[model samples]
Target: MKKIAIFAKVHDPRCLGVAEELVTWLEARGLEPVVEAHLARHLKFEPGTEPERIPDSADLVVVLGGDGTLISVARLIGERQVPILGVNLGSLGFLTEITLDEMYPALERCIAGNFQVSERMMLKTEVTREGEVISSHQVLNDVVINKGALARIIDLETSVDDYHLTTFKADGLIISSPTGSTGYSLAAAGPIVHPALDCLVITPICPHTLTNRPVVVDAGARISIILRSMNEDVFLTLDGQVGMELKAGDRIMIRRAEHRTRLVISQSKDYFEVLRTKLKWGER
Candidate 1:
């Protein structure tokens, strides 16, 4: 309530303008508005705070962009329990559900501590090569393992909790948290799991076997995927934002994170409403 952080997608001019307006509004109410160093330069303010420091310094983080931008902030918050308010600059977003018209009202409730906070689960993903951990990332969405454009169908020998599951011969495999059910997992014919459920979904992308279907597993399950395809340009993408090239013998491990992302829900709408608006339910 005292120190507020503002982050916006610089690609959209409207987001930047709204961020500036938010700064002024927050300042007028005797609140300190701290901005990221890169965004501060664009807003004509002196740079003092870094993006990583937002979680530590700010009481609340207001994001002005789509779900992608909010996802980046979620990763930064990483176990910090800070609540994030996402304002959709354009159309209705899955994660960024709050609209421009409802921003101030939402902020008013948030400032007064009268708002509802929804806690969504996160995923801990890592890459291991030759029995050594090479890379690790915390994601609010799914962990994707796919091949490059030039590569053919890759093999992913997957398992759950030390049990051998199956070898999926497909273009990719999506290991998604329940909160990420509406994302790439849905596009790959995965089930739309409710965010409240603590579970994981494994969906194969364009599988060679028609019988290979998406499977929903317990949240405590640890998915171990071993890349068995050689001479293929395989990749491991995290939350559709950051990616890394994978070798043939590399191992991809995914598990439920210990912490969750606390999101400030839209005051006027619910999750079903969001699905209806975004997916156009009951429409011809």
Candidate 2:
């Protein structure tokens, strides 16, 4: 890809220096580097492209930060199908598996058109209030419906393909894609599903019923949940980034989205290798 877009966590002090070097490196190779507006401003560079407009012109996107940063970019580039290279500046990350030391080499491979990409499924979430659609979002990771700290255990009436399931009495509920199995869902005792799998995971956060367990379903299944807890502080979060407060009668619809996020695989390591390293597996 000739047009490379750079997205960085501008809040980090190290990002400025690394972005400067990256820009110079790309220029020396006769490649065009497009910087996100916020990062470009931090670097004190002239006019930069806005985040929304980057997908229209960029052939590839390179995100420099933790998994959170990469996840936000994935949402921003909805339906574009552009490949993303995630470089972690700090500790190991599930999504940003590529380390800072391996960044340049990975870019070289991408520039040479010799790279592999993993197609990760996304989720489409809609909120319906009083028979009218209020808001909709596309998320690469999990969708969380949670109760406020002061609120008592909330009830979530869940279903699959219009079939009534159980009404979950818990602190919250998480609906995640296979790609997001390692995220919040995993923390709530959800399964660690392989990214290649086409499935959805439903995990309850601190359920009232001890037997309540996480459920895995086909990706094609349409899951629905309604908030049954009245006059309580309930919220719906998308990828742990953005969200909205939920009402008593709010209905949530979640399903696999038509678009998927394409992540460039790190040539230096495989998925199991990442898992072992990140989770400290097999370590005494």
Predicted candidate 1 versus true structure: per-residue lDDT over 54-77, tens digit per residue: 899989999999999999999999
Each candidate's TM vs. the true structure?
0.98, 0.98
TM-score of 2: 0.98
lDDT, residue 67, candidate 1:
91
Ten-residue stretch with the least lDDT total in model 2: 89-98
What's the true lDDT of residue 122 in model 1? 97
| Model 1 vs. true fold: TM | 0.98
Q: In candidate 1, list every pair of residues with a backbone clash.
A: none
